[model samples]
Target: MERVVSIDRVNNLVKKSDFISRDLSWLKFNHRVLDQARHLDRNIFERLKFMAITASNLDEFFMIRIGSLYNYIDYGKERIDYSGLRELPFRKKLLTEAQDFVRAQNEYFIKRLRPLFAENQFKIAKISDLDEDQKEKVKNYFRKTIFPMLTPMVYDSYHTFPILMNKLLIFGVVTVSQTDKKDQKKLSFIQVPQNLPRFYEIEHNGEILFVPIEEIIREHIAKLFRNIEIQSVNLFRIIRNGDFTLEESDDIEANFLEELKRKLKTRKTGRVVRIEVEETCDRWMLRILKNRWEIDEDNVFRAPEGGMIDLTGLWSIVNHTEFKDRMPDRHPQVPPLSYSEQGETDIYEVLDDRDILLHHPYNSIEPLLELLDRAADDPDVLSIKLTIYRLAKESRVTNALLRAAENGKHISVLFEVKARFDEENNMREARRLQKAGCFVIYGISSFKTHTKLMLIVRQVEEKVTRYVHMSSGNYNEDTARLYTDLGLLTTNEQVCNDVSEFFNAITGHSIPTIYRNLITAPRDMRQQLIELIRKEADNARQGKASGIVIKINSLEDRETIAELYAASQAGVKIKLIIRGICCLRPNRPGLSENIEVGSIVGDFLEHSRIYYFHNDNDPILYSGSADVMVRSFDRRIESLFLVQNSLLKQQVINILRYNLRDNVNAYIMNEDGSYTIKESTGEPPFNIHKEFYEVTLDDIQDAKLF
Candidate 1:
């Protein structure tokens, strides 16, 4: 057995102080996202899309973060948050902030977004706002479609309370009995069908009319409760605690597949953490619900005047074709920077000659997919091994792998079934792959395999060569077009060996070892990165040029943040472009004065992870799936491979440069953890999203060397 080393527990107050609450930082990131919706620079439909994105983002936040917090509070387990508040106080503060955010979100939709949408010939109509003809159409549609799907469950003395599904819009109807001598009120619930569209759309007079399904039901709900006096009807939605740790079940550690299935079923009916009720809901009805759910007023959010309970349903309108032509077309992807070839070049041939580094969305993921397609049919190919965290709904990656497996080529796949919100998709895909005779591993026992890696072995004439693909994003082709990510396709001998060994260790019982180029995690990535930072600090103290530049999605790990603080104190300039959940207190006096942190929320999600360290004059670069989060280091399995090729290294540095130069959609982090938009003082608009789309070889040649 490996000896357990006792390290000094004293962090000298670094852990508690100078850090923003993780939850609060995440909410702030959402606020940044919300700002995109408010920004008028984007097209109307794009702005609507951003608004829907924020709504979807908030739904997950409530499910995961809010749900995780109550998992402690509800069970009476004492815990402290990053903000130094104990479980009870933290819960109070967190819920208050969450309620405030919901209020602002609703206010935005009702006040600004509604008017803007109205100006664009779009209207979310109520039954009262609709003409008699439109009302009759809605009534007929409701009776034909939504009426049958709704099952009105009564909650009274004889009946039990039904299990309300999470995140579903429900109509809480309070009715009085038809024949009772004494007046009595009864509560009945009707859940809006998940299958039906959220809105009944009717094109009228060149304007798009979207009537909320709830509104239509409100108009005709009397048909369901015939002869009964409907006193009041409240439209509301509930967000249940959908977060569950694998540790909660012994069955999870034993049979993960079965436990995952069971957990998916239970997630729908988890404890109610939040209730978003229409602002006009009767107080007594609200009180009854709060009392039954055993929750305080803090748990309920009053929806704005808009009848829509869930703003995420706005995606239906965003996807509507009425304004499709008004939106800008997607930018065409240029050929990848390093490979220096067009579409006709063979991927294997290019990779054999030199490594190819791709900056995604700007550069297509086609070459990587093409490589797999060719490898699947290639007579020289022996096997293909890869790790999958999240797969696209319609995945070319999976299809290619399936074809490879069917061609009698050995395929080893490590599918992460522990990916939250993606577990069902991963599970289904993994089972499909397994049925196709592909050797599928359901991740490691306790940890998620978040690394995006693939190794293909082939032999032309008794000489075997390995081609490997590594990336910072998923194998999801759809996301590849929406997310800014970096990927490498190479035949480098050292990286290939390291990836092969990584697969061996993950698939079998052997412990993962240190690699020559790949800095793997739950073991070495954190220490390796810290050592590099300290080395730069050492260089800075010696009066040599020293700097650190990193672009990642989140930076929440305290150890890494402390190292960056230490590096800043040593006079090493640090620049960070974090897209979300940055907990580091940048630009603070005596703490992190030399460090600058900025975030860019643009057309594409800033999903890539890049680490650049100035080694005196030379620079070290790496791109990988790992973020600066503790989970990426100590909990999940991750890998960061060095960009050894000089050209590829420069390309990464250029990416960092472009990200640092981003101002249009960029927000700079302040000492207090709030973000301010990075304003350009009369400088020409230089949007990285636009610049990268049209990047040519001459542009790279003329660019100043980092």
Candidate 2:
């Protein structure tokens, strides 16, 4: 018999169940990333890459999350968050945590990686540590190259503080005016040149020494202001508010593109949310900056120990050619369709046999690219339609679409113009598609179409066939090499018909009330998920076999969490593999004792979303682009498809099994919402990425012989 909770106990669990703040949970995720930098088991260069990634990740977090919180405080809109933290107190606590995180990151980089780099024949040398010959060379290089690009502006009666662009490093010079006999200090600033490389290499006795451009500029900053006595030159950067919400305007369809462009241009001038300065900066100088920016002490981030304010630039050092051996070898991708001596296998023919599941950074994304290439050239293919959220700078997919249009094939492309950070690139690509005589839709108003779908309508023989490719990641080829994602290719008529209706619903005014195979958001995806979870709970209550497993980037939906809690209380075993924010607190007694949660962070980001439900013996699986966040549930156009093919279902099952078994790269979440890294005692360490890479290689090799 299944254990059941009394009505009173259930009510108490509901009232007491609290969520972790999304912002704080995100920091915990980043900390796991920083833990990679602290781990001695990983390669030195790879560890450096982890530190650099964390730096880049934090930059965006401040610009969006922290910036939004400050806006709330500014407009007297202080309210309690999901975690029951008021806006003011949350900001204070979050700032302290951010400071501690930054301190820990700096300590790890300085104490742990500094000696490792020296032993590996690579060094980040300070200007003071350089020999006289190297110093002279750096001085000359700065005077000739960097000095010409700098423009120093003084802050006084005539000029106000220059509005420094977001995330740009600049020197805040505290100087004594030479014109005044008394020692009077004035403030001046100069932005570091963006075009110059962040790391400058000096070859001494065949040993490579990496030097930061900022140090070179700092040593020569005094020369820029010859008339002033340079008292102190502190390096600093600012993160501005980047939370831009598009308001509904009349005639939005006509001027939406222009308005979006305007917003992008003005985003740089948003309110200053945070300021980062060197720890050695004078107290008075830091105070003046704080007062001018109107930010409190919580917004001030002092990098007392980190070598650089922005470690993202350290990618130049981490990716140097000399240290390639220290980094993990790039696994050779498995081409799904291998050319045989008899003939090249048609990709469509392969899909017709069975649905192919792709695990990225392990299995190559080339097969899907080739599928599009083949569709574009085939005379039988009538039209190509796809929704693009983000794309690489040089996107082969878009280029192929252009070629199809040029070849007299109809092409329809939906470009999401508000995909944060990639808006400009999306706009450029949309315009390029329009120029090629292809039909283009900007996006649905009040919603962003984030589904990864591509449908090709091909007329094979007397019947019309629809080919579909759906994935959990973007179509960007570059990110496919970095992010772990899943994609599916199938010629199933039911799925293709639903995809057809999906495009119509987004591009036109058609409201799809039913789908043959796919579950779509902003329509019924959330309800479908709730119903599925309820079904599992019902099974558990009936004393039938039941279990739930999900792998997603985030889980923040309250309704979903409550349903999972109910299921857990009914004796349903629940497992979650979330890569990022997970507000759901698991393993709470009488609340979620049957639930377990873990996250994996390593070389390849766990970006795929897979949901599995054990329906009495037969299991059902789904893969899609949607996370469990509220934004994805109600405001974004997303899709999740049912995986019914037995072989494909088992492949996804194995994927989850490996991630669950991972002891080295996985972190388990505690009931308090903190994560502890998984450790192997006596048991052999199993890394999911490594295991998947080797298995896929073997599968590809086996296919080659056939």
Candidate 3:
């Protein structure tokens, strides 16, 4: 055996009880998030937000994780889970766990949240629950707005079964046509349009009432099918497989773009992985679906004794303006450690003077956006090159690039058209830039570019300077306020030149011989990272101070996990602050006794990737978008930049220290792959998410600094 990290070897590795299944570990993260929603300590709206977040998370999980499982199971391909189970058994376990989660969520919403709705002046009511005036208004609104958008598709001997859209709330009406003497049951579906509001909101004397669109439709659905006696109206939502690989091609613009568009449609019609139905629905109808869709019994989840509840709709309530004041306030972001509390920053001048490191949500993203905005119109700027993985819908980042292109500055963008769910938006925006005379590459052939890098070439005062911005996140302003990320702004010649070369390699489709300080994936990143860990292990064995701290979104690479285990065995103290999906088992007596794993499910998404190694107390730190996952290391084109600046390095070190100390929002991973929510034991509580937002310079100085 080569001992490589792949599905082929996962069973062998797991048979030794060395790793947790990645999918199971991910579900634990979702459970931790559900715990957050269950917390009565947080305000109701905040809990609702977390509840909605869990729903959103599960949607993607079904689309990607569960969908991938079926890709093997349905195709009759051989596959084994990292947990050592064959595909069939693994799918059973995964779906059972997911079904349990869905049930728990629904029960919580119904028992806990539904009761709170009225006390908080918000009610999830039926038309019968509404007053006469409110009822009339809702009925009229539905008849006028919703009725026009819905079409009932019939299925019988004469009619074909309708194609139901994925993840949409659909009403399955079992009606018997009065015209037919046989009284044959005709199954017809009315899919709620994705664009329509989930609820029809009406205010009655300061009390906000939310009538679920399904309720409104159910009440008047009889109108859609005239002269038919409706037997039962049941609501269900199905998730279709969304995973697909684009055929690699040398010509991406003309070939891959159209292929991607066609594939996107397949998501709506692909194999149904899971079907969620209202509890107490017609069993015959459910059986019909199960047989027709070829979905197993485990795949059909029943709502918690309530009519079909799409918990994702809770987001509407979470973001509703009326309840926002009741939610936890998103405190204003303070200036970065390098920024001064003064007028608008001259980002170029600041970078020219010294490098600036940004910890997002704690530090404003305005400075970065302002950099691009200024570069758009700056006379000195000759070219702007950016690698975009995701963008805000109304992007100031896109606007700046367009302005730069129109201003005759060379605008080159590598829009990753294979960025999962964001492919449509990326393609649409990429074409806009392409039309504006900007040189746009529609991503590399097979590897998805996940690097976040921007290079602005400026010639000022007869001197050419390259200003580089790198980050562990997207260039989206909206997400910057909600995701905890790290970014760097620098004009250091070597670093800038390295970024230039890296950009040239990707855009020019040529591999660079060297990068001064960058470690890129699908190249030597895994090797570099393993070597770094081994170096720490050797140092520890030599009786020198050695430690490793990694903060990332996921940690599932088996090879990397093995190396970390080896380092731990060698007495290298390891602390991992992974936000989600950690397969590495920690605190195992002899295997990983020195390794500590913590997951923070908190105020903002913990999205940054920070790698730190204690080189005999001379710390080495790198931050980038790469997670310690197989996709990040072997499949995606990712890069991690070395942080050599003392202040920046010190600041990131402090970040690891804060996260490790956090009692709130932290879950300690146990040897059994379960998490224990970290709690204060007589000591005052500390939340890293809050500390990063509230701690001042003086407070930070009290901790060890560079």
Candidate 4:
């Protein structure tokens, strides 16, 4: 473990303290996503999808970031963060900021969506506001579907607060004892079962009416507590600290899978971070609940007027097949540019000729899946190797590997079992692969192998030839359709050989001392990035067309930020397209005057990492999984490879240009640490996603690239 240091040490190292707080920057990013929900041009259902995404994003933020802050405060670790605040003050600031964010989200939901829903003849009706027929339907649903599932848990001197599941909605019920009216009111809560649908939809004479289960409970919850006088019934939810550590024990030390299962249980009992109550919650009731939870005012949140506590339940509406016409048209994935060359569908043949660059969601991932599926059954293929960071629940990639292993081919798969939230799934897949006779390595201890890499060793005419696939995202096919990422399919000997060595370095004891065409983290990725940036600066000083363009998910590493500042100081124009947390203070005179940062949060997530350096007309482009974060550089195992193929290089360059030029869905980061939406004056509305879908690969191929 690295030593815990103060912000003084960080400032001394960087020679400046102009970085933004990581947590606050993340909140700003979420707000940017919220802006997408507010976009008038997007379809209503698509806007609702954006809203649901922001809700889910905020939930995770509270569970991880807020949870970690509490831990820091509890442990007396008063280390100042980048924003020059200690743990306690930071926690207070974040809590207040989060409260405001949730308020805006709820206001938007109520003000915009309610009218939109009503106008569209789809209404989320309250129980009291419903007509006689609708009321009867809700009453029937409460009896038939909801009544049998509810169990009201009581709390008193002998009883304790129930182990509330994380992010699950629960109702706080206040009741007066029948025997003594003056006695303290009994406090109880009924948990809403996640298995049941959160809303019940009914068709009324061509119009659809959707009603929340909570509203139904408000009318019918008295039945759960038979004899007690129900004084108040208010809806509430709590987010808990989901962060957990794996400790070594006798049984756990031997069995990591069992340990993971054990640790998952502890996550439920984690400390409560935030308690969300309805705005109409009684003052006395709120006070009593806060006392019981041992939380202060900062941790309590009141729902916005007429807004539900969790917006994730809106997904059912967003994903309804009936609403398809109201949502954006789903564009079919296009075939790769390499596919039309001599009309070849075989990835091996295409890769053998030249590298294939894939821009996902716009371009299909079928070619990569096809590569694995073919290698599994190929008689010449001898071995298959892959690194598993995250995979779909039903992964075609995993299925291909299983088939290859079943066919007597040697298979080695490293499942990073420490992947947050995906740990159990990866463990399950790892054990399943192990049972099928494949060599399954859990992970390198204390280091997550986040690199997206795969190597297939095939013997063609008694000569071993390696085929490699590297990506900026995971092997999950489901995410490929939602996240815009770059992938490379190559048979280049040096790149393939280096990737093979990378696999060996992880799965065995052999260290990769030399990498011919790849840059890996915890090795040389950071150093390589610094040198590339400095090279641009050097070129600018020597009177060459020098600039740098970076498109990444985040930028938070202090050393990297310092180097960027230095580069900007030396007159190297830098353009950063960061989709998430960016700590670097750009566009500052004498610090980073030549730098500009823009973020895009659109229909699809901008997940690909593309780093470009204008090395005096002969530009260099590299893309892989590593973000400009401290963990990616110094802790995690990451990979970034050079774009050597001419056509593929232009494809990456074109992607950067498109993102740089997008005005409708892009926001430029301001010097005040906020973002302003990029507006179009008289120019056509430019949406890179829409353009990517409309313009086919053949059209892109025909276009000239300077």
Candidate 5:
């Protein structure tokens, strides 16, 4: 075990911290995700999803974060993190810490959560525990269903080891041939068919019994090895490196697709990162398997409670009818916001009346959906342009764009094919759009088009008018139903022009050199944000009620963090609601004494990025994709639109105020970067999300009645 340092020492080290690496901070955020699994208030299926999410997140972490770290280590490059602290060379130390993290996760899964699952009637039974009738059913099922798909391999001097597919679960068994005079031994293996269900349900005496598929395979091993006596059986799983590398050749487009296919194949043979073995495995069998795989002892994990190596199977258990009712239904709340009374009300006109903010899941995404739907159908609309990062599987937004294209409206869609894990989805959608007569842009070769904006040009009579919809989330209606985000529909000419130019630049039409009222990244967002913070500091020094409120997914940008620290020193009262990866340390004496940071994690994901600066005479508000991260500001394509209308600014401020006042679900972040749930007081505890939902629903209904 690595030496454990005192909390004070860690704080002292952080005091001089120049850059807190975003990767490490991100890992801490994943810990928070894991924390949700431990939360009692969350439903069982929700908890299961959280666990699956964490596992899925870690897999990506290994592919991206750890993969990047390994690249840096290989090249002997030393880079500092967002905190400006020098990162130590990645060697044994980092690997050791990673191993420790995995071990802790395993322990938490087994000791804390799995037992609770078992107690809740989600039983995982073994074959030995089966009765005569149950055993008979299992035998019949295996013979009829599993036997046909079985491909068993035996290892000897003549036979080589079979190729184990990545993330595949299999069993290694030692068998002795009864026909051999010397009782010759052979090493054999059988895969738990990926196509087969992880758990098999048997109905016995009107009670449901679930047994792992591996148990049935174990019981039927004798059939596969007809003339052998099974000496020992051990279950194991393997994780291989799955990082995809894109080539920079002249035929980049063709190369990319080819590389993607190659990656899919290479994923099975890449270096092993992790291996898991059942606890009951014999020492000799374990050694032989490890030696064959060339896996080190540190890479091996022993399953607890003789449990199955992978509990992702718990997803199947979650599907059982008994637990299904307990899961929250998040769809009904996202019904159409506008009624028949608001008939054909122009989205831009509605926003012009007041800055309308929509809370997803609780309220509805229909207003935003309606905006695009109307744009597509409106005959007067000449052109529609937008940037798509990751649309939903069945994207209404994409369908709207297709409709616009088919209506002879010139449509441009900037599809970012590099949106991690959604690469294939985006690529498929891009091809579909192209086929549907839409001019599709595959995004800039270097930077991802992460900004979410829609531009509509309409020719009404003798005049050309521009309408824009700017948002802090994707146009993905499905996620819009679950992710809390903000969208603004406006006829502001300056913002519209900037957004149009942005789409044009991304699609290789024309490079936009300057944005009039918007802050765009890889260009001016960082400097503009710093200048905004400085303005706040100046206002504070002049004795005005200077304050700043920001709600973002992350706050790991060093310059932004330092500027915030400076603003805090200048008496600017700063409140930050960061949902994830916060590097800024708040409430420290002489450093960030005036700054307070908190996070809200609930049923819906808080995905919007909103910024409010008290400008003394006139406050300024903006919302966009930028998250105060260096990469967001300097590497990726991002946009922040200045909220010009007073009513809209007030609405934005109100949302921030509500979030800050939330006590029921808010987790306050301390100066040391740790978080604690807000303790309830005597006053009615504010569930900001729920309240926002009710307020929006009431407002929409009232507007309809009026």
Candidate 6:
């Protein structure tokens, strides 16, 4: 298979087509997020949040994505990516481009958006502009609130340089004596106390005025050195490597909690990635910083208009009601689901007759919660097992597990503690579950268990029966309200048995191979998908109506992309709805001419992964957590369920059809990674998500009458 899709062949095809680099394409996506910040149609506060999100997203990209590239370059691995093009050496070309982009973004923010912020009555005032009364107010506020937490240090040759924390902004002052003629220059640094608010509000002329803490310190630099003429002031911020490593050692052990604590401490001193300085800084100050920090010119960034060191702090301001625009009318989820539910309704009974699919945010997640709650209290429940990759901070699912344990029902929670940003939260939940007498298993150390599965063993008559809930999203209630995901609840014995063995394999019980209804990763998912694609190719060659449709967040797995390309060559119509990074180059003759891909970026994040294959006269549909990425297919534990029910299969098909037909938010991918927004025609257009939400409401109403 690998020989068939030769690198030379792929490169030749790529050379003849338009294909943008993946990293550059990702930057364009971030630009779209920045565009949202400038969109006048959105609420002002939401736009500010978008701006903050873009900044935070870039920080992570630098820390993880770009940092990984640097490591690859350091290791001398100059191999090309899936796109068959070699990336330039890290820090050699990427650093310059990244810095240039950030400068442009900061310029837009400061010059255009800052004035708009002032018009909204949320002003960031300079300390020198404050009058006597406002200065006194600030002084009193600082003394009463900030002085107790103040820590000041002088940086000189004698004292070791102060360690700057990651992403922390600090004020550097050069205090010199006015009377001292010979040489009078003294440098002092004050670490901005992280505990204090970045913006302090003061009322003047019945309007709210705010001052940045750094600016306040700039104003008071003269007072700190009464005998000297203040030479210059500079504001600087640092970015440090946030990647953490686990090791067996005396100081920091491999225990998750201890390692997390040690990581938090070590993060401050990690390798400095970049440094941002105030634009007005003197050459001497810049030289001292670069020399002392051992930072190269490429690593230094002079902010345009003294941009905010951490734009995330804007969230605090955005949350203020006075400056925010009115929120749009939002339809709640509960009312639709409660058409016949003013009284109690058993979820199992509803699912027993037909498969119930839940599209979250449009549909209430309360049904799933209620199912868990019932299982927790019910004596008929024998056992409950779940795979938890990420959960909400205050998760009711955890609470239900605790209750189930208390009720003497065997409960197990497979907690993947390495769920990226939520590692600490998962660790905390794992500890809580362990302390509550529930069996809590840290997932396989080699691979993250990204599967979303829940199993409930209950007594039906004298026999025990199993029910399962498999979803494309986490059991996180918070994300469910924002991410578009699909959930399936069923009592299929084959699926439940497969899930049981899958969980057992992760929890230290070795299980031999067994045939199952669902496609599970790290074992058979990749091969199964490949086989399906081959079957489709055969059908297409036989002059049958053969095609494949898949919707996922990313499409980069080499084998899968090759298989899809082969299928496309065989005349199988391939439609892909990928929301993020895609390496597949379509529209090239003898390769992927029959393949087409589009993305939908709208109000809610499109996160569900669905796969559909035309099996001659029959169609096979699947919805699950696994994307076609290598991590999903060969590393993580994931599941993709086959839709056996005719109705549910049709419903899934309908969704794919709607998504493919959508033009409002859909962007078609070119042979290059760039996307073109599909233009709508004169007909009343269909917004897929909006239409789905409305249909779900109608379905709920119709189900009530029956």
Candidate 3 runs further than 4 Å off: 1-16, 177-183, 341-345, 697-706
Per-residue C-alpha lDDT of model 6 across residues 345-449, encoded as one tens digit per residue: 667776565566766767777778888998999999999999999899889999999989999999988888767778879988988888889888776656678
- In model 6, the runs with Cα more than 4 Å from the true position are 1-22, 73-90, 128-131, 174-188, 203-208, 222-229, 244-265, 288-295, 321-325, 334-344, 683-685, 696-706
Candidate 2: pairs in clash: none
Report clash pairs, candidate 4: none
- Candidate 1 off by > 4 Å: 1-16, 181-183, 248-254, 701-706
Question: How much lDDT does candidate 6 score?
Answer: 0.75
Model 2 is weakest, by summed lDDT over 10 consecutive residues, at 697-706
Q: What C-alpha lDDT, on a 0 to 100 scale, does residue 321 get in candidate 2?
A: 82
lDDT of 2 at 419: 97
Assess every candidate by TM-score. 0.95, 0.94, 0.95, 0.94, 0.87, 0.88
Tell me the whole-model lDDT of each prediction, alpha carbons only: 0.85, 0.84, 0.87, 0.84, 0.74, 0.75
Model 5, 613-684: lDDT tens digits are 878856788898789887787668899988886555655676787787788768888766667888877778
Where does candidate 1 clash, by residue pair? none
Q: What is the Å distance of residue 361 in model 1 from its true position?
A: 0.6
Candidate 5's C-alpha lDDT?
Answer: 0.74
Which residue ranges in model 4 land beyond 4 Å of their true spot?
1-17, 180-183, 246-253, 341-344, 694-706
RMSD (CA, Å), each prediction: 5.1, 6.0, 3.7, 4.0, 4.7, 5.5
lDDT of 5 at 586: 83
**Model 2 ranges off by over 4 Å:** 1-17, 181-183, 249-254, 335-344, 696-706
Model 5 root-mean-square deviation: 4.7
lDDT of 4 at 399: 92
Number of backbone collisions per candidate: 0, 0, 0, 0, 7, 4
Worst 10 contiguous positions by lDDT, candidate 3: 1-10
Better of 2 and 5 by lDDT: 2
* Tens digits of lDDT, candidate 2, 1-706: 1123243443333335477788889999999999888887777888889999999999999989998897787788967776766666677667777988988888888778877876678888889889999999999999889889999888866677788888899888888876775537788889987888997899887678888989988888878887668888889998898887876545644688888988887778888888888888877778888888788776887786546788898899877887777787787775432222112577778777667777887877888898899888889999999999999999999999999998899999989999999999999999999999999988888788899999998897898888899999999999999899989888898898889999998888798779977888988888999899999999999999899999999999988988999999999999999999999889888889999999999878889999988888778789989999899989999999888776667677778878888998999999888899887877898987778866642343322100
lDDT of 3 by residue, 598-694 (tens): 8998888899999999899888899998999999988898999999987777778788878888898888898888889887887798988778877
Compare the candidates by lDDT and give the number of the best one: 3
